[model samples]
Target: MAGPGGRMMMGQSGERSMDFKGSGRRLLRQLLPEKAALWVMVAAGVGSVALSVAGPWILGKATDLVFAGVVGREMPDGLSREEAVEGLRERGDGGLADMLSAVDFTPGRGIDFTTVGGVLLVALAVFAAAGLLMLVSTRASTRVINRTMYRMREEVQAKLARLPLSYFDQARRGEVLSRATNDIDNISQTMQQSMGQLINSLLTIVGVLAMMFWISPLLALVALVTVPLSVAVAARVGKLSQPQFVRQWQSTGRLNAHIEEMYSGHTLVKVFGRQGQAAQEFAEQNEALYEAGFRAQFGSGVMQPLMYFVSNLNYVLVAVVGGLRVASGTLTIGEVQAFIQYSRQFSMPLTQVASMANLVQSGVASAERIFDLLDAEEQAPDPVRGARPGQARGAVALERVSFRYDPLKPLIEDLSLAVEPGQKVAIVGPTGAGKTTLVNLLMRFYEVTGGRITLDGVDAAAMSRDDLRAGIGMVLQDTWLFGGTIAENIAYGASREVTREEIEAAARAAHADRFVRTLPDGYDTVVDDEGAAVSAGEKQLITIARAFLSDPAILVLDEATSSVDTRTEVLIQKAMARLAHGRTSFVIAHRLSTIRDADVILVMENGALVEQGTHEELLPAGGAYARLYAAQFAQAVAEVD
Candidate 1:
């Protein structure tokens, strides 16, 4: 599924809450595999939060102790002489005498300035240490996130390479490309931002709640009243946002697919004068994407503000309760101050968690899509073990073979044929007579539904696909050229490294050397996309050169000369003769002249061999072959006169 170019929703049921139990655990597992550094970072994060919470409480305790010792001229109210001595021992020898000597009790009760300075210094040290820990953990967590993203991208790409051809046929190229590139990028972004924040937020929440309860259970109870309410609201919002995000992503994929299709077929569209229609269709798709994106992002955007508002309400409640306790002399001002700070710390992390929900939801949606692709069935496994060219005989036989792309409509029914080793067999037929399909079956692009094909008396299906394919060289009607130099295209299918001399020789054999040499870079010139800069005949010749370089035992030329001019076709035919000298060959052509010299001509009609013989033998039969020949030759003679 695709959404718009930039904005994407989650899925159809836009109200479904994030499945924390299902997707959250799965995503964590996926991320954890590469997060060897993350566990250390998590520990550091906990330490940072611990230091932060401890600094405030320790400072508050130290302040009250100094006030009691100096102003009250005794140990703190709750501490006995033994406890006060222990507190002094814990403070260590660092400025202990100066702090004890500066406490004043005669005139006005107050803490020694020296003792306050020492406490402030210790608090500052703890705060600085906490900051350092946070920085290290954040940096380490980010590295883990980036490494995990890189691994995911690589794995997805490898999966694409191994995927079956049928999957490509059924799915849109743009949609697949978006998943592999854009969607994965989004997942990476989400992971990088959310992982560190999530860890820090969780640690902060735990640390603050523990500190609040330790200070005063009653105040802590009041502070936590909003926690469940905030969580409930967040859960509802997240549930509503998940589907919107799924839909947004789906619409984005569809938009990308539409754009890809339109651009790839731009020439055809213009030629047919359908630009207006194409633009209209694109606009409509774009509008649908816009709607989905707005709904998904807008919903997620409201969650953070709502969370903050709830947190503020809880803060006011905590303040009012803690102030009354302080006024009644049950709680010290220092303790009340610490409680308020802890309450804010607790609520702050909740707000951050709420803010990160959208990214988490988006990542889950992307992960689901990626897993779906990874789970698809791969190509059928090759059965033959240690298969190689058997005897180099080049004989092919189809025994009662029946095939169908769809079971309801058979394309080739019970077709049986045999080609002797080194025999040049030409198959001529009208469109849809299964000419190309026959060759495809021989090459094992598709498995036959019934019967079997044999090569050198060995079952074709039993042969290793690579071995079977390596033995046959093909030049298809629509030639494809990669974006590479001329020499590279010619050496495309060679098993071993090919030299420049060999590449040139193959090009010469295919009569492609003349044009290739005339180019600006000769054989080293790079071709544009699909060789769009070159003529169709030039591309075809390059494909022929590639096949010639392979030098297979069998050759199949499927409409190889159909797109070329007559003069070029003649040259190509000459090259084909040289290429097929001692190899078994199958030629499929629309033009009658190209295959007239073939050793055996099989005229096909409706996927059946209606006539089979040499040229002279077929003319005398007065069957379908004779009638076709008579009509063609009669027209040729009339044109000559």
Candidate 2:
């Protein structure tokens, strides 16, 4: 079953199996580019097939010539050892001695003066042509496969960038990484091998069958007796092994996810003393992967031996019938020889097909997974009408807005609020009181389920998502830093040309300049993942600097100082005041001291605002705001003492 956000659910029964034929064709179409070079490669494959069949026939004809001279009374038109010997005997009479002296000769096998040179010439040409065609086909197919893989990788990466954040929240990072890297590599390998071998094998089988029938229909019929049985066995094995292969890949992804989690949280695990439990859990996942892999591989491995046994049985029957016909003198020994060669050729391709069955099956499984992701619906389209810079007034209004992450439980219920230009409004609440949800709606990360939000009389849904986001600046509680210089991080969202002096000024306003200047490279120093090089307070300041650089008409501060010490909080509050100047600001905070100066304080509980007033007004009213203020103030005082 697929869960919300298109995540697959695992169970004892496993997910529904995919149709290999349909999935394979669809994947191949997507991967192959629409270009003339691709068509040329296919044409080369066809030519190679034709040349391969010709090579085998030429070899078979040479074998027939030898068999004719040895067993049949009639000599082959081409020269034989006996005929060459006779020619040498005639040449020894001294009339042709001069001609013989001009050529180098080997003593073991005398050559016929008339026909040996021509036969050797034809044979050499046949082998050379076949080898040349094979080489061309191999090269062309490899180029096509590599180009196809390059396109697939590019598309997958592009899709990942465009996918909504909610998709990442539900899907495992390790699994997505596995699909893009390991699974796509497998698909490319399969395409290369299958393209080369499948075409060659099919041509070999067809060519061998045609020759066998031409030589003797009875022998051809005898050799084909194993075809149906081989196909039936292979089909059964493929069906049984397909599900195991899928399960093996699924388990591999889970194992990768577990290992990534454990490695990333090593410090937390040590603090909690969970080393032994983590090791045991890892061992269990390893065992599960091993079991699934073994079952899938074991089933595929038995196919070759089973196919060989059936082929040998058919070979014996062909030999007996061919020998009986030769004894009755109705068939020449050369024809019997040709028939035997053709029979082996027919069986050989079936053997190859059997061996490659598992490769094909695994490729199909990978294709199915890849296609599932490609077919997922993308985020809803943004409005086509472009946004122009409006008047600097930052009035924001929400009219009966309602939202729910899950339909069964509403996070914000019919809430409406308005903030005039240059107003500093604070939303105070406990955990899960719809504070962050309100910010998310205002940023349009998630759409409102019902009602409308307008900015300066423009409906948010009617504006381009990019334009909407660009006009608002947010400082989140969790600050994310990319691997870049401090100057780059501070100016991340600045669209206009911003000078180094301007970046430094923003950092100073956010109270981050003193610490940044002391670093080894100052503004040029690179930050590690999530700014691990800096303390949490420093990271918060850098985020505030980024917001300041954007110079947005509206500012949102969501628990911006929640994780910092008291002194750092005081510094950030000063920076916040500077940033909030002349902008419509919305602050969501749990600490009472942070929001005490808000021009309007809205108290929310259970998804709705239960009270609205200034700090002084709310305290005397003794409503939800007063109760929250009292509780948080007591905690702050105890910490201070």
For each candidate, give its TM-score against the true structure: 0.85, 0.86
TM-score between model 2 and native: 0.86
State which candidate has the highest TM-score.
2
The local distance difference test score of model 1 is 0.80
Which residue segments of model 1 deviate by more than 4 Å?
1-24, 58-113, 384-386, 602-611, 615-641
The C-alpha RMSD in Å for every predicted model, in order, reads: 6.9, 6.6
Q: 1-641 in candidate 1: lDDT tens per residue?
A: 22223222323333344454576676677767755688779888988989998887877767665665464454556544444444666778424423333333322334666777888888999999999999989888888878877887888887776665556766787788778877888888888888888989999989998988888999999998998999998999988888888877777877888899889899999999999999998998798889888987888889999999999999899999987776554676668778888888899989999989888888888777676566566667877475555486899999999987666787788778889999999888777788888888898877888999999888888888888988999988878888888898889979889999999999999899999999999999999766876788888888889998998989998766766788888877788888888999999867677777888988887877677888888878898777777777898899899
Worst 10 residues of 2 by lDDT: 95-104
Query: Once superposed on the true structure, which residue ranges of model 2 sit more than 4 Å away at CA?
Result: 1-13, 66-117, 322-341, 386-389, 496-502, 565-567
Q: Against the hidden true structure, what lDDT does model 2 obtain?
A: 0.78
Residue 168 deviation, candidate 1, in Å? 1.8
Tell me the deviation in Å of residue 297 in model 1: 0.5
Clashing pairs in 2: none
